[model samples]
Target chain A: MTNGSLSEIYAKAAYPLLGHGKRNVQVLKEALEQYEGELDSDMYGSGKVIESFQVKMADILGKEAAVFFPSGTMAQQIALRIWSDDQGSKKVAYHPTSHLEIHEQDGLKELHHLEPTLLADRTRPVLLQDLREMEETPACVLLELPQREIGGQLPEYAELEAMSAFCRERGIKLHLDGARLFEVLPYYGKTAQEVCALFDSVYISVYKGIGGVAGAILAGDVGFAEQSKIWKRRHGGDLISLYPYILAADYYMEKRLPLMGRYYEEAKELAAYYNGCHALKTIPRVPVSNMFHVHSDLDKEQLEAAILEATRETGVGFASSIREREGGGCYYEVSIGDRYAEVPQNALQQAFQALGRKLRHTAEL
Target chain B: MTNGSLSEIYAKAAYPLLGHGKRNVQVLKEALEQYEGELDSDMYGSGKVIESFQVKMADILGKEAAVFFPSGTMAQQIALRIWSDDQGSKKVAYHPTSHLEIHEQDGLKELHHLEPTLLADRTRPVLLQDLREMEETPACVLLELPQREIGGQLPEYAELEAMSAFCRERGIKLHLDGARLFEVLPYYGKTAQEVCALFDSVYISVYKGIGGVAGAILAGDVGFAEQSKIWKRRHGGDLISLYPYILAADYYMEKRLPLMGRYYEEAKELAAYYNGCHALKTIPRVPVSNMFHVHSDLDKEQLEAAILEATRETGVGFASSIREREGGGCYYEVSIGDRYAEVPQNALQQAFQALGRKLRHTAEL
Candidate 1:
């Protein structure tokens, strides 16, 4: 009878999973039972919950302090901004596909008024020589661990250490975009603390891999984070209270972190299985983490419909189609999380089988 | 024993009253029960709950579209960034104490890489002539209704209308920093639509007077907002879902918006009462909105301790000290909301009596 009918198509098209639903309910209950007062001032004015979360995040990341923000975009951008401001320069260097450069609509240039010196080669990791060759000195250098656009590939640990040293000698602050850090941990065979130690500041997303409702933590030295708090307030990132996210994050971390190793193993197995399949080809033969891209022969839309139908009928989940690659077929990113890891390998084979059937049916018609 | 003490003074603060615990719990339960597997895709992402709130907000603010952000800081910064990008200039004009300036550690300068042409005369409303007098044309101008730092005073509607006309004539965009716009509305006898109609874009906080957990809405023409979505994702404000704040905001708008008029009337009466008191002084003789600054003769820390003690004993929540004003006394801000309105007026008078007694005790000792 209302606007619900108009959006029903979208509602039906989306995947329905148990983890997302359970997290939503848990957050809602926390909101109702705990938070009730002036939204702006309640959190910023005197609520100690955000401060507690910051301290916890700082301790976890092995930093002196941490600040919780509404988005990693602001966290990373602000880190760059602070680095630039301290150096009294307007230049920041980062990968060409860095979230700030591609995603922020030139916010660095437009909002923070800084200039980005883009490192152009997309296929390889940024080397010290590339940074040293820049005609102008940059205020900071940003590195995204397991870059998202490139299917979560990471630079070698030795190269990262060299990059850190290079930045330090030149007095450039280093910032890490660890949005999918949990995924990268198993690939590096390193602790979160160890990886974060190399950067002056590290930003980690709570909702992405941790499976909390929504939040991010920007961890750094006490002075750096203290400065970030001022920036957070200015950017309007400080909330009324962060207890719901904090509490849920605490719970999720305990439950999900241990399962990541299993997820990584499952993803590797899935990749191997897909490589052997006649109808599909995986972009990366060996995924560095729990996610890899799959290229399929089936039409993108038809493949999606078949997958959705199968998921609805059989109660299994998998991505249907990602963006079309440079070549003829479409690429779908298969991510292994706590729940997805539990899906039987045969179920995935069945999903592809369903896609084949749908393609055959369409051809006959 | 449990990692850290939860009973610390900072930890014992109250949670914001923003959403219905039962409804939030129920929705979260349903999400977990019905839609746990479909968390990644953007099409029907469980985050649609946040989208629902945005739709409702757009309707309330009389905008073509609205985007929900994790933080008001990110929302407003992106709003200004979009305005500047559209205008092809990077300078935005606003009050010196505007959240973008005073609070953000110059992030507009550092992160967005934009410059503020400060329009710093705090004595009067920003007039059309102010824009005319600028040495160089600015990309955008921001107006903070019920300016927070200056005791919540707002410019006259006629003046704001003239400012809007000036911006249109110059092809400059006007942005309304309506962080506390709800408080200013009843005083001006205007709806949110009327106030927002004067600007190209408007930013409203859900957690401020509305009393929800942290969130903000940036409402504008659909085109401007579509661009903001890109900026939102880049800033990391886009969450897996926003149902908790959205549902709470929807409930708050219905329950709180109607009651703001009553809070405004009460604030006016309270301002009048404080003005008549010989020992206490109200900064602005007439209450422009629900918030006002109080200058008290009592010592800052002792007065704060006394006020907290009185609040605990009497269940009256009011001003806590912010900073020292020009006089020997300290300045405190009183923001009237639904909770404070429920307490009888006599509680305020009783609190004042308690304050006087505490001050006298300090002097005698």
Candidate 2:
């Protein structure tokens, strides 16, 4: 909870709500200590440590090979370019809320000349029916497992199978933006290999859920991986050395990879508790992948003030931040991790009760 | 010298010739150790250390702002893209041997749709007369200072000034691929600022002569730097942390930057000695920078065998490899650094004497 970015939150949190991953500086320190016997790493990206990390990730993802990138933004763009070039079409289909479309500042179009077509609605997971309805076919279809922007909702397994078959029949390549794949696995109740089997390529973030410093992994068949290496050099994703990120990633993967199941279990219980509060509501009413939308009737500023007052007076945290909801009022993205998992039911109830007392004078919430 | 790729040469060198940059792992270790008292950098690329380094570079290059990139490939590509977009023309001009043309595998054309026009002959520096005779102006004219592949030669200072003025009058952007800017300054007898002032953008490699692991700096006016940041993010040149490269560059700049003058002086002396040999000839009969081309009457394999035997018997190494020359025999790029600076004049004379003796037995001459 006290990693450099989270230190501000930790200092203020009477109890910090767990998020998608860990950010504890002390824990990171302990993680680096695990590399005790290691001297250092290679001059550039290739070395025993980085190679072993990539091999382990490849095994976990059930891909023929995996290459580490300094940024997911670069990896995803390169993946789309590869698929699009092979098909001789620049068109790629993605959800309106996909990271490539929104977060990357249109790099796909501006840098790589990739044309992205928005599929389905921004509020829900993309469906097979959505693809069938398109006027033109795209060279690739990119699916974000447990879509993040809409509070972590995944398509049903049968629906996903239908969509995969549809893409295969059309000869359209499928790629997975599996940044949150590890955390979402417990809900899917399947191995990573099973989920990735439907796609030609998959990209996972090293830090999003794995608690590495920063890096991304793109995995696929041997040919795709080999070709991506050339693009990686062109895009400047090849670092002089990746050992620091690999060491941290290896330590956390060993410690946290298997613990996602328990984290998801605790998340559902916590969502139920949040729903019990009259001022707050969870989006789906049931947790899917340790995350859901949290809404309050108060506007952004008032809700923030109330939370601050509650924390000041009773030393309890309600949420990280509140922003104007799409419909009205204020909302936040609720993500549960180890910190929230450790909070006792009675203690959480007290936290909500204290926040309620502070918001009693507010009319909206 | 015995890092990874350099181990083969290090094991054989009674004394090895420096080509391009440092590969000494011990020096790299010392560089990393300098940051022992510093905490880890900011989450992304905006820590105090990174900021200071960028500021220092901007000051040295006399630019309004400077940005550090993970690789020179990203920096140059982004710079070309920016100039092309601003000029509303997709054409960029360069010498036939430009790194952007030959080394980057035509990424400009394939990735960004920028058309490259080879403006001048490969045997000599790009002259203003060449641009004047062109039927159409290019979006950007990229000039490499003391062009790396052409035995490190630069245009006359007056000719460079005339080219800058011509581009300005024509509303054409000019960029400098000053990857070896620091080392080439002595030849021009001008500060980096004086040279960079003529171009709209300049890129310098942190590792080429500065001895960092790997990184590059792109500097220009305020607006250009701001625009380049977006491209930097889009290209994935932005890293989670750049403090290691920053720290290493900072250390080496302090230690190595001032010594370039001596290296250049010694390089001239070494070239003079090699030019004296009957079998080996130095390009231009003198070195403009700390590097020159050595063309020998001996073919590639013969040159390698002679160098190996020379090192085995007398413990003096000439080069790593010899490439087939277009005309006949073989040629290699010889770059001088601190290691070469330490060798006495008599030793280099003796080494060249031995090479000439071996080449005497060859029929290629």
Candidate 3:
């Protein structure tokens, strides 16, 4: 095939996440336009986009400076390394469900050469008592905002404040894994800056809710970020051109950030909708953000097939999976985003109605 | 603008790079296509493309297996880390200008927790004596082919063979930073397999010459690569949907690999063309591969302006400046690639003519 045909095929196949949506397309287009006519090459050092993204992130988080990285793992690992170096300690304290501990394949130990002191029984939220109980004082403590693996539960504001103060008093640096920071903002009754101020450093993802291509920005004081840039390049996060991601992030922030509150409100209503349904049961009585899980009596394979079929029929998308619950029935998460938020309440009701019909059919069979 | 318009803009801007250009784009496209419909999000456990890429790379390098990484830095660092762990030593020996020493921001020390024992000698290639003279016994030694920061020079085949044998005798693993190994092949009068066979692990870039979107493949024994995959996820190298890179690499191998021999010949001819000219001097006497540096007596600012103007006039690209030589002259590298090789000999001659004219004009003023 010709280059044009091949590119079309590649685009269609590769960018499955991009669909025929005005909002998604507009966000990406604006980003491309903003950065189209520039070299943006890092002739002297780091690329221009990376530099600007870092600066912007730092300012937003009320930090002195920031650095853009290709992946959150590199950023978090480097952060731990710097903390360890500063404190002259090779051990870090964090909850068991922290991305660094669970997701990063023991990179903190294997790559960074640091030992993790995992705090067990963090099913609710981390507290100062938990920090006080540690036998060995760690160089740094990692806290995740609205923990992911455990259904997005966050600690109370007073407890979080106490934890931060305790770390500060003990000369321990606090690092926040704000992967879903935006989602946590409304729930905590705080702004990004307000929440980030409690930590020495913050790492945010541009691709998650912000809907950028793929990149991360780690924000911290000038000294910290400068050091982080060196680590960034060391980890091979530095690229020749990063304007695409930077521009996409800028566009997404402008377009989608304002709608985050709406997403939260919609999520609450959706959770309430599921709670009232007979076939479906809500996991967390109240969602912390725009995400919650639903328990259902339907079979896994049958539920997945039905959801896929129903989405095709109704043009409304919902995740379908029978996840084994803590008690008895299976559960699957229902995450509401800007896309789902735009669907009218009546349309969502209709989707649930279709889901009910499908579940009943599976039950009868 | 609409999403269609946005995609069109992205396509236009990214077309040259990602199009079927017989470069990295082809490889990335191929990789993405292979895992087209799979939605496996995790890059650590049961990584999507790493296992397959490793298998393919191992076969290409004549190794037992291979590992996939997000960056060459991580791959090389992990290789050294594993070597150190196996040998129960923290020190590794490498040339002063090796990528691990200079480019990676001391990641071997900070991230991998390895001590680099530099084998320094600006005058000649590293020999067995250099390795023996090291105060500490290193766990491994790194050898970079066509050393990048040093104008792409290589050690003689006899010297390389001796070094390998010495390492073998000492029970030290040898690692090759083959970032530009493809460029080094014709110069050494050897194939990739022959060079790679001397090393325990090899790291190659898919983006550099192979022309993928962004990726590196670490080839080694099957067991070694399997372990590296776990490390890869820890480093955040595991990406979602790597089929694009795989496809692009497959296509680039088919189209660009055949042209490299011709590129080598043309680069030599180009170097000779500059050597005979009075206005410009070729460094290193002869071109080893498709890259060489040209030393000019012209002022740095004037030279940069002239090169920029020449690019606008001829639509041919060249790096403005690499660094200043010790002998009061500015140096610029000319990389002969698919694009550079396509320029006619006359156009190449004209570019030089344009440079001279701009310099003379500046002198008159």
**Listed models, DockQ each:** 0.30, 0.31, 0.23
Scored against the true structure, residue A41 in model 2 reaches a CA lDDT of 54
What ranges in model 1 sit over 4 Å off?
Answer: A1-42, A45-48, A82-97, A112-143, A154-174, A297-316, A341-365, B1-47, B78-96, B111-141, B155-174, B296-318, B344-365
lDDT of 1 by residue, B1-365 (tens): 11122112212323211122222233223333333343322321235566666788898899999987766777888888888888888888998678887776665775577888878565554666778788888889999988888777777888889889988898989999898888788889989899999999999887677766567889999998888887776555665656555655666666678877877787787777667644466756687887777777755665566556545555444453346655576667767775554456576677556655655666566
The Cα local distance difference test for each model comes to 0.69, 0.78, 0.68
Question: Number of clashes in model 2?
Answer: 1
TM-score of chain B of 3: 0.83
Q: Rank the candidates by DockQ, best first.
A: 2, 1, 3
Q: Which candidate gets the maximum DockQ versus the true structure?
A: 2
Using all chains and alpha carbons, the TM-scores for the candidates as numbered come to 0.79, 0.88, 0.79
DockQ: the better of candidates 1 and 2: 2
lDDT at residue B312 of model 3 (Cα atoms): 54
Q: Model 1 chain B — which ten-residue stretch has the worst lDDT?
A: B1-10
Predicted model with the maximum lDDT: 2
> In model 1, how large is the Cα lDDT of residue B14?
39
Each candidate: chain B TM-score: 0.82, 0.93, 0.83
